[model samples]
Target: MAGTSLAGWLLLAIYLPTIHGLRLAQMGTMSPNGGDDGVDFRPAYHITPPSNWMNDPNGLMERDGIFHVFFQFNPSAPIWGAPHWGHVASRDLAHWQRLPVALSPEETYDIDGVFSGSATVLPDGDPVIMYTGTSRRQELGFFWQVQALARPENGSDPLLQRWVKDPRNPVIEDAPPRGTNFQFRDPQTAWRQEVGEELGSLWLTTIGSQVSCVGAAPMYASRDFVKWEFFGYLHSQPGVVPSENETECTFGETQFGAEGRNWEVVCYFPKRVGEEVIHIFKYSDQIRGRTPFGRDWYVLSDVPLAFTNKTVPGQGNALTPSLRGAPFAPAIIDHGDIYASKFFNTSSGRLLWMGWSFETSTGCTGTCSDGTPLTDARGWQGLQTIPREVQVDLETGQLLMTPIGEVEALRSAQLFEQGGMKLVPGARRALPLKFPKGGSGGRQMDVSATFKLSDEASAEVSSTGFKVGVAVTHGRTGALTSVFLNGSLSAGGGGVEELEMWVDRSATGGATSANLQGGRVTLGGVAKEVTLRLLVDRSVVEAVGQGGRVRATSRVYPAGRGDWGLELFNEGAAGSVVAGVEAWEMEGAFVDDLW
Candidate 1:
């Protein structure tokens, strides 16, 4: 789909608003399929997509003050096909401003893909989009799905530029009964159902289903947002992981419901405050595996369809599996490589999120890992995991996820600081907080630490207590990437002793692209102070324990250069670990005019 030559559409409407209001223009991170240079691992502020393939995080929305995001692109090549909606904006989600591809597949009911949906700002402020439109109905070769709508051809350029697609096309054509529009699609992000009295002012949504095989979401209402009305499956797949005696087994009662593992792209998140309201669902790709990894599950429900009064004898009100006990127990909120997306709303109700970090589809079949060759430069895959703010700890419901204090305004200084430091038993330690400000070595960082296990690491767990770790190396081809706090190997079986995380990049050879990327996380008992938080850019590290239950994202590619930075090991043979650490120096959210 690459044929725009009217002088490239009039220099793209004056270079897309002067490159979205260029805030200084050094324009970092620019590979877009060119000769590579590494540039210390890209991601200056995260939310990439100036080049090719992007997954989920579609139609996100915000208004007047501006914030749209929209994604799932593939504009002419990078990888996946069909996709289209890919826009960007920001009044200050930290200087982002890209906009151009907002919805494509250019017609005939979305010629092929315009997947993942959600985005709204109505109430009279104008801004509405609800997507999921495919189209390959050769009399039904299976791929028809509907639900479409778009707007903003002129809210007067809130940076919205041009949209407008509601020819009534497939505003909800069908697909839910036999369930094939490739398993329904993503929808969530349309709320407003409390003007009471018989669903007045209705406008609720929640697509993403699977019917007979479990995993569901199907529930719609709409009033003027383009006719809809499903009202059926509201929370199935209740078996919410339990098994070893704890009961709870619904993916149609096990074997992961005949190997489909269900669940995909489902979001719900209600969240309200000042009047208190919460709900929460969020989902995406679960089990049925040989490497099924891409989790983001959640449960805590009280609204948006969670165990909704059952009735699925022959699939009437759907949500089957004979619901009865264990009403809520999903939990997983993040195992990193987040997906789909959620946690939207705001105006004073603070809490923002945006996911989709996928890109581990190794059908690579020939040279990668810097040797190049997999074509379109691996089609510029995924990115966009650093837009958090998410809150809801109202007493440990845990989802605190912080990364948005405008990312500490992108740091810039504070280089290093320590406070307490201990490391008995076979010791080892390294340090070099942020370097590469101007002398140029690249690696951007923003670390924060606090690990304490002493008391001989909770009174001995045999040896290996002091393996407290942190390494992002290259000190001459030791080409590293480590993260360990071996609580007897990240909290193995014990009586109240959790909090575990161990990541080993096999010396920079780990994270085979799509990331099944390991880095265990136990976070259960063992607590004497455990707070690790890292964000190291230069091949993305991520890692956030203690504040977000437990996380550990991945992506590494060392390649070796000079001594490189960061190090602090602390092996053990005696036991005792205590740390304090703190680092800084980030700055670089790309395109300051393409440095």
Candidate 2:
């Protein structure tokens, strides 16, 4: 509303792909008041709402070659509040068309707000949405939440613009006795199974909640979209202290509340790995230790397809007890600011994963953790991480998530390329990529590099190890964000060292929520080679190591409008060689208003 005109706002009703496709460079000079505020923090290629607060990617689905992304949005302000479902659609993941609000507070049950939910395709091929509706229910004695349903008015519309709320909404009328109304929400996509011709098919989904003293993802069974029955939780975890030996799935003590107090955004899916079908269950634990904001934790269980459909809902199947003491344990997918993750199968029958990357900069009126007043000046709050192709590693029992190949379409020019460079201990050299000729210098890019330990380095098995990595720094202010490969070699001929993908943001100039985050990088056993891929979009930094065995999504604020700097550094007892480095300047996606 600042620099945007009435006509400019009205232009949203007209779809103009050509106008939005123009590079940000050719979009003409920007003003501080305009939508393109010339702010360095506005990500060029990432999916952000046209304006205001946004979080938790929701209602993800595909039909007719077009993909749709819905999110928790506050249409009025740059901060969170009573939410509406904001939407966008794209034929390809790289380009998006921003649409109007999908669902708003209309009925008395949802008058307060419309929260997070998912979209599932029905048997007949039409997609239906199930969401959480919130309002003060006098009978319930508190602000309550319940499940609701919505369907596209016209199934033929690929964009799915107009949605009609089901009249019998508050579909699952009340919360299960195990959880309070306030705690039960985020109904995930439903899956169907054929159970003999007599029973036909059964639809099953889960909702996040707390039951008794354990955090749980409670399952629900339904014959039709309108009626749902509570079945036992698919998984649950009792509160416990954090231990290095335990998986991230184990509920840990935090300042917010006791572990298992509550869980949010429960997601489930099945993928066949070789001959086994690994059922993947994921949830967002907002009260987990180390991450006061929240973290997405997942576990892979080898539940047979027959047992899953036959005894799951009927016997109230709970897989936690069996997985707790097993080697196949729960793990943190992306160890950073990402949370509330959800997945959907694409038109090509590929499982694609996405998560909400919330803002690290505080929006409060008072000073932030960094002593700054506020950082919501840009009129946006969150974004969706680049869609990742998901696959289960049969050998390691881990999930492999890599940026979808569709993202390559955004690559404009090759920014930098290098190969076979030796890196000695204590050696630090700058790269030419810091200050590129066009676009925001090093702000928007796709970079991938491979590092291999030299013969001498691989021979040493010291108690303490080496660290080698690429660093992104603000040339004017020296603000730094470093992603490193930390490990020590084994005594054997082939290095058997266990490597980790560690991200350090302690020196980043501006406000940030987390300083250090990392995960074990399973480099196919011996860890002879480490590959690091980075997708840098202004304030957001996503790093994938070992072909997505480990990932880190961080929000970094680098101070200065001057050139950026990229450097390679090595520290410790030995040296490593940079096998290869490839980088490309990415083009901004057109997320313009479309009716």
What is the Å distance of residue 30 in model 2 from its true position?
14
Query: Candidate 1's error at 136, in angstroms?
Result: 33
TM-scores of the models, in the order given: 0.36, 0.86
What clash count does candidate 2 reach? Answer: 0
> lDDT tens string, model 1, 470-585?
67675465667776655442333232243366556666742235233434454544455666777877666777766556666666555534535667666754345668788776
Give the number of the best model, judged by TM-score: 2
Residue 5, model 2: lDDT of 40
Name the candidate that leads on lDDT: 2
RMSD to the hidden true structure, all candidates: 19.6, 6.0
Task: Give the Å shift of residue 168 in candidate 2.
Answer: 1.3
Model 2 scores a C-alpha lDDT of 0.72
